[model samples]
Target chain A: DAGITQSPRHKVTETGTPVTLRCHQTENHRYMYWYRQDPGHGLRLIHYSYGVKDTDKGEVSDGYSVSRSKTEDFLLTLESATSSQTSVYFCAIRPQRPSRGTGELFFGEGSRLTVL
Target chain B: AQTVTQSQPEMSVQEAETVTLSCTYDTSESDYYLFWYKQPPSRQMILVIRQEAYKQQNATENRFSVNFQKAAKSFSLKISDSQLGDAAMYFCAYWSQGGSEKLVFGKGTKLTVNP
Candidate 1:
């Protein structure tokens, strides 16, 4: 609904392989985030980009890296995929600034990744 | 860092009845926002309601309303006239006004509406 799209909606790869999940947004929002959902864990932030080339690590940023080369795209890469990394990844965008104290984020459908 | 807590792992309510989902957070910041998002089987996160910390009055959207107690740091969602379509996993999240850009979320509470 946020003009956000995720590539490889479903992926199945073997361990030790490299995987990248792409999140592209048409809205060109300033903020983009990567979150993974697992049973009993709800959702945890992996990484987020506030602007082009600006990225920050989240609580569970281990073994995961992100790159935002353009305003409309954010990429999440796993150098070496592991079975523990198998989870549903989500992409979300926040409009403008949060100083206004209000604004709900729009999220993409999600990308389900499985490691064999 | 702020953390959210959803004590109930799952809840059940009969059709046309009412149900409440409990959420609490630990934060030292006074200015912030709270949100409730619903994720159905389709896995799409839909905004159910939002509450602003500065506003004393509770926030409501149609049949969905939030009872926010800033002092107690408890935000509970009340659903009236629960329908089968209301069955989904609900998440409670928090965001600071001028601080943290991250929107921290709780584990989640799954709601089941029985016919």
Candidate 2:
């Protein structure tokens, strides 16, 4: 298992409230990603960071934003919590120089969020 | 755009039996990578196996193996002598060799190992 930790393992918030999920990694990996898993939708990428201050949009980055000011911490924030955002969010890390051609992702336990 | 498709929503296999999970992906890029991730009830994504598009040989790890057919755009996972520990949601994923390392995952197939 990777030394990755996600804060607020479980959360319940109102629909209009803003929520922020934090992911911390001790491995100091250069690549970090955020994904949401819902029934029938599997895991959809919300956003990812290649390096500190370098971020990019993912397939489902509409209402979500991510920041990586420090190498060890990556944060995902929901502008306005919605029921559709209720899902298990996972944080993953990969080495900057991948040993194998296939980049394998080491994930955190996951954060379960519910929007009422 | 790249897309991964896992045709089976759910699958069951008896203990000590073999089971195959199918996956197909679409990509215009010539060089890429394919992977199988296992998400147990705990919801931790674990890497099971991986196959490089440029390699013709399949990838095997312990009880897991993948049949990679680049020409057909098919990547399937075969578990030999399935055990109860193998019961989980298996996802097929794709990643480009260049550009970005972020993966695109398919709707996972739930696998049940019958006791």
Candidate 3:
């Protein structure tokens, strides 16, 4: 186990509501990523943080945003929930020490979101 | 842009048999990494195997191995002695070595192991 925990294991919210999902890791990994998994679609990266206050957009970062204020915590927020945002979100972390291709990713249990 | 493709949407194999899942990727970068990740019913992603483009030899983790055909741009995963536990969604991913750590993933293949 990577000691990764995602808050609000499941959530159901109405459209236009703001929702934030928290990902906490005890491993102190330097790289943290937020991704969404939809049916028939593979996991798509939304955003990732290399360090505290350092973040970058991913392939599917249009409606979602992420912030990492500390090494162990990464947060993903949906400014206004949409029906299209209803999917499972996952948090992943990779150690900083090993070279680029050295470390494997450790993922959280996942958070299921439903927007009506 | 890098793209990963898993042509098979679903596959089934008898327990104790061997099965190979196909995955192909398109990327112009020469230096990169290929990986196979397994997502079980728990929805927890687990790394099955990884292959570095620079390495000529294939990567094998226990019964899981990858056939890396860099020239053909194909990376396929083969599972030997399949077990019921192997039933899950398998995703093939690609990551460039150009400092961008984000991975491009395939749609995934749902594998079912029957006894």
Q: Name the top DockQ candidate.
A: 2
Q: Which of the two, 2 or 3, has more lDDT?
A: 2
Give candidate 2 misplaced runs (Cα > 4 Å): none
DockQ of each candidate, alpha-carbon based: 0.79, 0.83, 0.72
How many clashes in each candidate?
0, 0, 0
Ranking by lDDT: 1, 2, 3
Q: Model 1 over residues B47-83: C-alpha lDDT tens digits? A: 8999999999999999999999999999999999999
lDDT of 2 by residue, B71-94 (tens): 899999999999999999999999
Task: Give lDDT: candidate 1, residue A109.
Answer: 91
Kindly list the per-residue Cα lDDT of model 1 for residues A7-111, writing each as its tens digit: 989999999999999999998799999999999999999999999999999999999999999999999999999999999999999987555236568899999
| TM-score (C-alpha, index-matched) for candidate 2 | 0.97
Worst 10 residues of 1 chain A by lDDT: A96-105
lDDT of 3 at A40: 88
Q: Per-residue error at A4 for model 1, in Å?
A: 0.2
Worst 10 residues of 1 chain B by lDDT: B95-104
Better of 1 and 3 by DockQ: 1
How accurate locally, in lDDT, is each candidate? 0.95, 0.92, 0.91
Q: State which candidate, 1 or 2, has the greater TM-score.
A: 1
Query: Candidate 3 chain A — worst ten consecutive residues by lDDT sum?
Result: A95-104
Worst 10 residues of 3 chain B by lDDT: B95-104
TM-score of chain A of each: 0.94, 0.95, 0.94
